[model samples]
Target chain A: MNPIPMEQSLMVAAMLFSLGLIGLLVRRNVIFMLISIEIMLNAAGLAFVVAGSHWQAADGQVMFLFIITMAAAEVAIGLALVLRLQSDLPTLDVDAMDQLKGGDDA
Target chain B: MFWLTSIVAIVATLLAISRLNATHALLYLIVSFLSVAVLFLQLGAPFVAAIEVIVYAGAIMVLFVFVIMLLNLGPHAVEGERQLLPPHAWIGPGLLAAVLLLELLMPLSNNQFIPTTGTAKHADHSTIPTIPTEAAPQLQERMVVGPKEVGIKLFSTYLLAVELAGFLLLAGLVGAFHIGREEPRTSAKPGAMEVPSQEGPA
Candidate 1:
C-alpha cells in the first residue's frame, strides 16, 4: 500500500473547499449556507492536521482544536442573530436581507 | 479503484443536497457521509474516518432526521409541480462528475510529483541503501501508536482543547435549541394561526 502524501491531503481539502464555496454561492437557504461554511472550516482543519503529522508535531492539531472552538462560537452568535432577524421579518430569504439595503435605513 | 469510490461518494453527496424531498435528501446525505468516511480510511487517517462517521453520519444526520420528523411535511411535496422545470437537477451531477474525472486523470506538476528526498548524507554509506526497498525489513516497518499513545496525546498535550471542545459542544446545544425555537403549537387555535415558513428570518 502506498503511504499517503501531503499532496493528496491537500487535494482532498481542495475538493471540500470547492464544494463548500459552491454551496455558499448557489444555495438560497441561510442554514444550508451555514452548513457549507462548517464544511469549509473542516477542510481547513484537515489540512492542518495533515501538515502537523508530517512534521511529527502536535501543534497543528492543537490549532485545529482552537479553530473548531471558533467555529462553534461563530455559529452560536450567528444563529442567534439570525433568530432575531427571523423574528422580525419572518422570512429566511437571504435576498430579502437587502432590506438592510440603503432603502430601509433611508 | 479509489477513484471509483470517490466519484460515487461525490455523486451521492450532490444528490443528497439537491433532492426536493427532505427525507430522501437526508437519506442520500447519510450515504454520502459514509462514503467519504471510507475514503478517509483509505487515506490511512483512521482517526478522521471515525470522526466523519460519528460526528457527521451519526450525530448530525440524526439531528436532520429529527427535524424532518418534527416538520411532518406533506407527502409528495413535489407532486403538483411536474411540468414546468426541465430535468436540470440530474445534469448538475453529470457535469460535476465530468470535471472530477478530468481532475483524476491529469498528471501532477513538479511541486506535487517531486520526491521528499529524505536520508541524504547516510545514503552514500552502505549502511543505508539508495533504494528504500533494498533496506532492512526492521528499519522499513512503520511506527504505529496504539490506543495508549492516543490517550496520552489527548489528555496530556491536548487536555485543555478537549475540555474546551466539550464546553463548545454544550454551548452549541443551547444555541441550537434557542435558534431552532418552534412555537409550542400543542393546539392549533384557528385558521389564521401563523405557522412559520422557511422564509422566516435569516
Candidate 2:
C-alpha cells in the first residue's frame, strides 16, 4: 500500500482551518467562539505533525507539543474570561458588552 | 481510508459550528477531534494521536462541557441562539472554504505533490530478507513513532521549550485562579444594614 500523500493531509488541515475560521466569525456566543479558536489551533497542530511525519523529522511533533501547551493555557484564560464576563454582565451576548464602545451618559 | 476519516471529521466540525446550542456544538467538536486523532494515527504519528484523544477530546472537551453547565444557559437562551444563527452565517464560511480549497488543490493540479521520500529508507531496510506476510508487519512498524524517540528529542533538542511550556502552564493556573475568584462584598455603604456573619438571609 502506498503511504498517504502529504498533500492529502494538508488538504484536510485546510478544510479544518476554514471551518474553524467560519465558526469563529459566525458564533456570537463567547464560549462558542472559544471553541472555534480551539478547532483552528488543533488544525494547525495537525498540519505540523503531518509535515514532520512527511519529512521524517521529530520537529513537527515538538511544535505540536508546544501548540497543545499553548492551547491549554489559552483555554484556561479564555474560559476564565468567559466566567468573569458572565458574572459582571447582564447577559453573555457579545453585542450586550458594547459598553466599551464609548457610551452616552445615561 | 484517510479521506473517509477526514471527511467524517470535517462534516462533524461543520455540524458543530452551525449548531445553535453551545453544548451540542461542543459534542460535535469532540467527535471531530476523535476522527482527527485517527487521522493523526494514519499519518504515522501515534504519540500525537494519543495526545489528540487524551488532551483534546477527553480533557479539553470535558472542560467545555463543565463551563456550559455552570453557565446554565436555559431553553430561552437556546431560542435566542437559534435566532442568532442567521442565513448569512453560511456565507462567510462558504466563501472562506472556497478560497482555501482552491489553494490546496493548486499543488495537486500542478503535480507538485511529492510523496515523502523518507519512506524509501524504511522500505529498503524492511524489504531485505523479509517473508511476504512479514512485509506488512514491518511496514506497519515503520509507520508508527515510538514514545522513546519523542521523549529523547523533546528533552534534548527542545528542553528550553519544554521549560517555557511548564512556565506558561503555571501562569495559566494563576491567571485562572485570580479571574475566577469571587469578589468580596463592600462594607462602605452608609445607609445599609449589616447582618451578623452567622445569620442566614432573612
Candidate 3:
C-alpha cells in the first residue's frame, strides 16, 4: 500500500477540528458541550500523531499521551462541575447561569 | 483508506453535534472517536490509536454517559434544547470553519509553501524500505515507531512532562472530590437547607 500523504492526514485533522468547533459553538447542553471539547482535543492529538508519523519521531506520540492525560483530568473536573451546576442551579442551560454582575449594575 | 475513515469520522461527528438527545450525541461521538482511532492506526501510531479507543471512547464517553444518566434531564429540557439552538447558531461557526479550512488547504496545495530543506528531507523515500529484504540493514535502525519507542522517549526526554501530567491528574482528582462533596447543612431547620448554596456567583 502506498503511504498516505501527510497533507491528507492533516486535512482530516483540520476537518475534525472544525466539526468539533462547530459542535462546541452550537451545542447548549452542558454534556454536549463537554463532548465537543473532547472532539476538539482528539483532533489536535491526531494532528500531532500525523506529524510524528511524517517525521518518524516519537515526540508526537508523547505529546498525544500528554494530551490524553490532560483530557482525562479535564473531563473529571468538568463532570464534577456539571454535577454541582445541576444541583445548585437546578438546570444545565449555560444561559441560565449569568448571576455575575459588575459593580456598575444596580 | 485514510479518506474513507476520515469521512466516516466527520459524518459521525456532524450527526452527533446535530442531535438534540444527549445520549444519542454521546453514542455518535463514540463512533466518531473510533473512526479517528482507525485514522491513527493508518498513520502508524498504534499505541496512540489504542489509547484513543481505551481512554477516549471507553473511559471518557462512559463518564459523560454517567453524568447524563445522573442528571436525568426532563422532557421539557429536551424541548427547550430544540428551541435554544436557533438557525443563527450555525452561521458564526460555519463561517469560522470555512475560513480555517481555506487557510489549512492553501499551504498544502502550494508546493512552494514548505521550505526546500524540509521537502528534500522527505523527497527520498527509497532509502526507507517498508518491506524487509535479505540484505536490508538492522530493523532497529528503521524509522518505524511503536509503543516501546514511545515509552523510551517518554521516560528519557519527556519524563518531566509525564511527572507533571501525574500531578495534574492528582489535582483534578482532589478538586473533583472537594467540589462534588456534599456540604454539611449546619442549620437544624429544614427550610434553611432550602436556600441555594453560594458558588461562582451564579
Candidate 4:
C-alpha cells in the first residue's frame, strides 16, 4: 500500500484544529472550553507527528510528549479552577463570570 | 486504512464537541483519541501510538470523568447547556471554521506543497532489525521509529525540556491543591466564646 501523503495528513490536522476552534468559540461552559483546547493541542501533536514521519525523525514524537505533559498540567489547573468557580458561582457559563469586567464607575 | 481512521477521528471529535452531556462528549472524545492512535501507528510511530492510548485515552480521560462526577452535573446541567447553545450560537463559529478549513485544504491540494521525499527514509544506524531490505524495500520505505530512538533523542537533546516539564507538573499540582482547598467558615457560632473561656480555666 502506498504511504499516506504528508499533505493529506496535514490537511486532517488542520481540519481537526478548525473544529477545535469552532468548539472553543461556541461552547459557553468552562469544561467544554477546556475540552476544545485539548482538541486543539491534539491537532498540533498530530501535525508534529506528520512532520516527523516526513523527516523520519523522532523529534516530532518528542514534541508530542511535551504537548501531552502540558495538556495534563493545564487540565489539572483548569479543573481546579472550575471547581473553585463552581463553589463561588451558580453557573459554569464563561459569559456569566464577569466579575472582573469592571467599569470606570466602580 | 489511514483515511478511514482519519474520518473516524474527525467524526468522533465533531460528535464530542456537539454533545450536551459532558460524559457523552467525553466518551466520543475517547473514541477520537483511539482512532488518532491508530493513525499514529499507521504513520510508523508505535511508541507514540501506545502513549496516545495510555496517557490520552486512559489517564487524562479518567481525570476528566472524575472531575465531571465530582461536579455532580445533573440533567438540569444538560438542559442549561442546550439553552446556552442556541442554533444561532453555532452559525458564526461554524462559518469561520468552514472558511479556515477551505483555506487550509486549498493550499494542501496544490502540487507545489507536496513534500520532496514523499515518504520517510530509513536512517543508516537504525537499531530496529524488522526492516527486511532484501525481501520488500518498496513496502517498508517509511522508517519505523521505535521507543529506543525516541528515548535516546529525548534524554540527549531535550533533557532540559524534560526537567522543565517536571517542574511545570509540580507547579500544577501545587496550584490545583491551593485553588481547590475549602474555605474556612466566616460566621462564628455562639459556642465559639465558651471554648476560649474553658481553655482559660484549663
TM-score of each model, paired residue for residue: 0.59, 0.73, 0.72, 0.75
Question: What DockQ does every candidate get?
Answer: 0.21, 0.33, 0.39, 0.32
DockQ for candidate 1: 0.21
Please write out the lDDT profile of model 1 over residues B1-202, one tens digit for every residue.
3465456665665665566554555555566556555554444334444566676667665655543343332343254234213466445545544553443333222121111112222322322224344333422342211223334567788888789788887887787667555445423322212344324222
Cα lDDT tens digits for candidate 2, A14-97: 999999999999878898789899999999999999898898677888899899999988998888777666655535677766
Q: Which pairs of residues collide in model 2?
A: none
Model 1 gets an lDDT of 0.52
**Any runs in candidate 1 off by more than 4 Å, and if so which?**
A56-92, A97-106, B1-5, B14-25, B72-147, B181-202
What ranking emerges by DockQ with the best candidate at the front? 3, 2, 4, 1
Higher TM-score: candidate 1 or 2?
Answer: 2
Distance from true position, residue B100, model 4, in Å?
27
Segments of candidate 3 deviating more than 4 angstroms: A100-106, B73-143, B186-202
Isolated chain A TM-score, each model: 0.88, 0.91, 0.92, 0.93
- Give the best candidate by lDDT: 4
Interface RMSD for every prediction, one decimal? 6.1, 7.8, 5.7, 9.6
Q: In candidate 1 chain A, where is summed lDDT lowest over 10 consecutive residues?
A: A97-106
Q: What is the per-residue lDDT of model 4 for residues B23-49, given as tens digits with 9 covering 90 to 100?
A: 667867887787787778677777778
Clashes of each: 6, 0, 0, 0
Q: Rate the local accuracy (lDDT) of all candidates.
A: 0.52, 0.70, 0.72, 0.73
